[model samples]
Target: MTETAAEATGTAAPGTTAEPRTTAELAPGVVIPLIGLGTWPMAGGEATGAVARAIANGYRHIDTAENYNNEEAVGEGIRRSGIDRGDLFLTTKFNRQWHGRTAVREAFGAATRRLGTEYLDLFLIHWPNPSQGRFVEAAEGLTRLAEEGLIRCWGVSNFKPAHLRELQAAGLEVPVNQVQIDPETQQPDQLAFHRGHGIVTAAYSPLGRNGSFLSAPVVTGPGAEYDRTPAQVVLRWQVQSGRVAIPKSADDRRQRENLDVFGFALTEAEMAGIDALDTGAPPRLDSDEFGH
Candidate 1:
């Protein structure tokens, strides 16, 4: 793939030393980087190289999932990064097909087995297995893991406010909720609900799946004054909102650009402009339609 990083406004933020700044607390004293490297479809040697380069470029947070089919490569990248496991914050998710307590435990065991790790910094229920119709059953396993100190943090992905309400109704406390977030897909209602009640948000598809967000008005309007690419501006917007954005890219240059967000800060007006881009806050990846 080709590499490109251009601020639509011609004024890119100055590059800085490769150290991630602290952001929201996933739990007491557990602060996560505002940005994370994501491996969705990249796998095998490509996955390995992408992760290796990302970590070498100073990405401390990594986002993966069983569905990506690249945990082994992800593990290889982490090992090659030469950063101690303690220095890197690892994240992965459990697919909705495996939702029961017994199944959830089996799922985590297998994920660790593939990732070649003993534990993850954060683990998420990829989606609520509506098939079971009683999604709370999986929380039993999470509570046990928390009690045992196996996984440090736990949460859900692609979940709506209603889903969080469901987890709360069952008395399960999820610290982070990963969702598809970008200028074009902002989830303000979801963000408001989570932040108001002490839950953090992780943004996926922050770049609009490659070249899909270049024409958004927010990217071309006020974002132009910042001289940032539509993608970078969106990631910046997510960061300013205090949401962790995990933008995925196999292209090395773009992967590095995704981590370049800490360089600039978005003003309140810019943040609000991104917020206004939300189109009724549609769901990006609903649990009900997921497969494999």
Candidate 2:
């Protein structure tokens, strides 16, 4: 019932050539696949089965978080997938409630136990929790985890450029900045800042939350030209534009379809069309006043 990356490659859909998944090296020896399976709304058996299916479909990068409340299911899916842990990149985050040094250590241990992994490929601070004003202390905990080999690398999520600057001022090295980004909420400035500082931009909601963006002419128009679905077009735009997209789907067919994106390339014009679709609308959650 499970498939290896090689097996998945051999089963590429008709007319589509199988190319190796694209990746970005966040650090000297850390390379993360550009496309990953997001485990947010997925929970319980559904999350477990979806993760297993995603692995079978050739997704090596899996993203989950403490707040997702599905780490156990994500772990079960990995076990069922029958893939070597080393071949997969597993990521999880520390919850906002666990912000201080002691809490981060305890939380990281709990996540490892729940996920059944000896070491995490990457770990993240779920939010800046700027109100708490203890992110510096939390980053220190992540630093300790990295040094002890509990986590390979550590970063932050929902972090604005200002928050990142504050962390940097305190001498913390952030390798990735996960944020909600879609054609509707382009985030060009944030992306630019992350790039300038060598932080990988991991897009959480690469496909607009409501799927409203899919109906846009820019997205559907390219889907028609490339004979691809709107979802595929949007995902391709993310990968092509150089951000890691973690789109969630529980359907097995959709899982396979999502990973099949590497076979095609989007033209510069097509990319521009998607870029022009940004409405600059407000994001779903404003980190400035959000989080635990």
Candidate 3:
């Protein structure tokens, strides 16, 4: 395998801003920005402006979902930025109601229309919906869509190792898997499975929600030494560990801070220190029983 962005690290003079062009190739000819803007829990005008400002701040990757109910706003933000659509990486996922070969296409068309885009950089099944038991067919649908050139790449979210094994057994390939990962709730087993299968791990909620752990000595110690915020320390660790991180922030300064991580590299000890913070708790939402 070619060296993934996650395996590589770069440095800049401390306290200076570095342009974030780091990306991981999830599949042939499909490269995703390592740091992306996650648009969820934001809607309407808020979503639009956050996305627009994110692009203006040099974010080239944007993540949204059909369930987010804000693809229209995200698309508008893209237009407002006046950047070429081809220059950005846009990702979205659909609910289980759209699970199936033909229904997946319907969902794709609807998402593109809502986002006002010609095609997507990546499309994902939001959850396995294992009880529904049609995710294999859904994965097949996304695969067919990719073959048809409707999407550059396709993947799944919140899928555990067992769910991925099913796809493997069905003779399907998963190029990427987005799940929750942070210093706490590291999901090492899922990540190990992804690495063993050459699947890229995309971390949603890269920062813990109600993240009291940011104040932990392990994280804050690095922040002080690197002249970065505690959140930046965690994001840097995520990147150094070879995972893609999409952190959400509607505030311009916070967005810029999120992107400023590439300039500083973390030491192995610091990396381990943060890694030691993993609580081994299951992800907040279980794909087995909880999926839209």
Candidate 4:
């Protein structure tokens, strides 16, 4: 594993901006950016502008999903950024309605067309609808897509350790696992499980969506000491703790501020402080019962 951006750079210099950096490698050719722009509950022109602005401000990774209903806007934003397709790492998910082998292929095609790209940097199954009992079939579909060169890598979201083990038992390989992770919903066990399996854990809602976690002294004290916002402190904790964080912000200033986390390093004590804030309960929807 490579050193995190903060670990490599020491402390951030005042008024200095750092380049986007990769925090983990999913495979031989697939390197995931430490921070990515998460697009959910954002759509149409708003999503387009936010994505374009984020890319212009040094965000190379963009995470969207079929259920987000903004693939077109995301694609347009990528176009507006004027950055080459090869330089960006784009990820989108297959809708739950599109499970099973055939549906997976169809959904992927539609997503690529909406995303306006020939191939996706990474693609995922948005949810594991276990009740449907088609996740394995969907995984097989994604495998075919990968072998067909339609997607560079494939994985799952909202998957528990047992769910991952199930897929593994089916002889499938998952490179990434996107899940809701935050100080309040720490998921240390899940993180450990992913690391044990060589899977990259992508954290959604890393800042706790309701913004309540920002008030924790563990977060605020670190922000005050580092001259960073609570959001920055939380995102920094994610990167430093070795997880890919996709924080959603439509404002250009906030987007730029979020990407600026690489300038400083969080102390072991501070990291432990934040770790102590975990309530051990997930902040949002539970995967097993969700999207069923």
Candidate 5:
């Protein structure tokens, strides 16, 4: 939760530029790093600086959304870092309010314009719209974007296993599915299904919003002998599972930590203990769409 938390993990800030290492290929053309930088609750100038610093310090993947209201800053950060648009993989989500055939195309266009990118690395349906029940319509817009070469890949956020089935049935391949996954609530069922069809899991709030992991004894407790925080452990779990974890931070140090998952490994025993904590924390972000 604090900016200083990441620095404690043994990574420092932008003294030199850092390059990204590819982990799992979300799709044939989309590769998401094991660790990605997240910019939510990182607003305005802070979000802007975080993006730039993340890139300068070696972060290649950034996760953002229209709901975050900071794409322009994210764009500025990309511009300032001078990292090639191709080398950096960026992701953003559409607002749930804009999820219909009537609005999907324009909303997608608006998001691209705001991010200042001609083609997005990935675009997600931010949340499910139950009332509309028009995932197919929205998927059509996404397919159009992909066909037009405006976005390389497309997916959804906060979708459950059943919802994933529905989207797949809609005839759109959901490449990257973003959700709030962490040590306390690792979505094995959801992740298994996603992997079964080659869909990538992009985790949001991977730190449990600093709520679940920090509360767990394994992370913030006497078990700290491993010299890693609950957040880092959860992040490590995400990486070990072949899921893309995006940890957010506005502070220089945490941003570095979010990007610093490459140098360590967790034992299978430790991973099992963490996996035991999965309690399926009651649809914190995307239940409405699941009903559709």
Candidate 6:
């Protein structure tokens, strides 16, 4: 049976949440929750505890990376959550050093060991380090892993249109691309390119740091109309607009709040209002010059 947005967003347990009911299919049988818990700038017991807390609150999709230096902690949280590994979607990324065809496999092995998982749901090439010029080879390696059943699917992160074009020219299939996107720094041209290529775009840092539009009436108006928080309104606008959002929050209440967005949606006008807040500023990090 198909699940309704409201049904999917409902918390599965009292004071606990269910996975986001809504999802974006990256490949056949490979679905990603529209809203995921982002684990960046978090580590050690703090990372482990936050991840466990999120799971207890019904967050089924978790995002982390080797660069985050918290995979072991994230893995610990997963064990503590006690949720079946099959029921949750875990995603992580590899760094530039592992940008070789075979090196990508080594990276995957190391990630699984630290994450304490047999296989990953989705793995990403953290950045397309153009100067190193091995991201394509890395992509090839990830694809091989997927074929061998090591990972469910693979894609790239921080890859701009030019980078993606190069991958395409090499005949690589990019199932997903995670990048920094928010209402304030929306990348229209980049998004258009993804749409044209059938690549799913997942937004990391989905909420701009202290986004100016959070208080704008366009957003607040909808929050009032829907009896939701400004952040919820923004997130609702995000998922409704067809982009996956991974907003980070270690606070229990905030994590729950972020997951609760699927219960309500914004109107066309309200969405457009938020979309108009784009400052046309470039992303915080330029993939061309910055990556590790």
Which one wins on TM-score?
A: 3
Q: What is the TM-score of each candidate against the true structure?
A: 0.86, 0.91, 0.95, 0.92, 0.84, 0.93
Candidate 2, residues 1-292: lDDT per residue as tens digits? 1211212222134324456457767665777888899999999999999999999999999999999999999999999999999999999998777888878889888999999999999999988889889888898998898889888888889999999999999988688889999998988789889767777788898887788879988888878877889999998888777688899999988888887787776776777999998888767888878985
lDDT of each: 0.74, 0.84, 0.90, 0.85, 0.72, 0.86
Off by over 4 Å in 6: 1-21
For model 1, the superposed segments whose C-alpha errors exceed 4 Å read 1-20, 210-212, 221-224, 289-292
> How well is each residue in 154-235 modelled by candidate 6, as lDDT tens digits?
9899999999999988899788889889888999999888877778788898878977778999988888877788888888
Q: Comparing candidate 4 with candidate 5, which one achieves the higher TM-score?
A: 4
Q: Give me the runs in candidate 3 sitting further than 4 Å from their true place.
A: 1-5, 8-21
What is the alpha-carbon lDDT for the whole of candidate 2? 0.84
> Model 6: how far is 129 from its true place, Å?
0.4
Lowest summed lDDT window (length 10), candidate 3 = 8-17
Worst 10 residues of 4 by lDDT: 1-10
Kindly list the per-residue Cα lDDT of model 1 for residues 123-234, writing each as its tens digit. 8888775656656777777767766777887888877778778888988877788888776667668778876677777888777754555676756664566566667777
Count the clashes in each prediction. Answer: 2, 0, 1, 1, 1, 2
Better of 2 and 5 by lDDT: 2
Cα deviation of 239, candidate 6, in Å = 0.6
Q: How many backbone collisions does model 4 have?
A: 1
Off by over 4 Å in 4: 1-21
Q: Model 2, which residues run further than 4 Å from truth?
A: 1-21
Lowest summed lDDT over 10 consecutive residues: which window, candidate 5? 1-10
List per-candidate RMSD values in Å: 6.4, 5.4, 2.2, 3.0, 7.0, 4.6
Native-vs-model 1 lDDT? 0.74
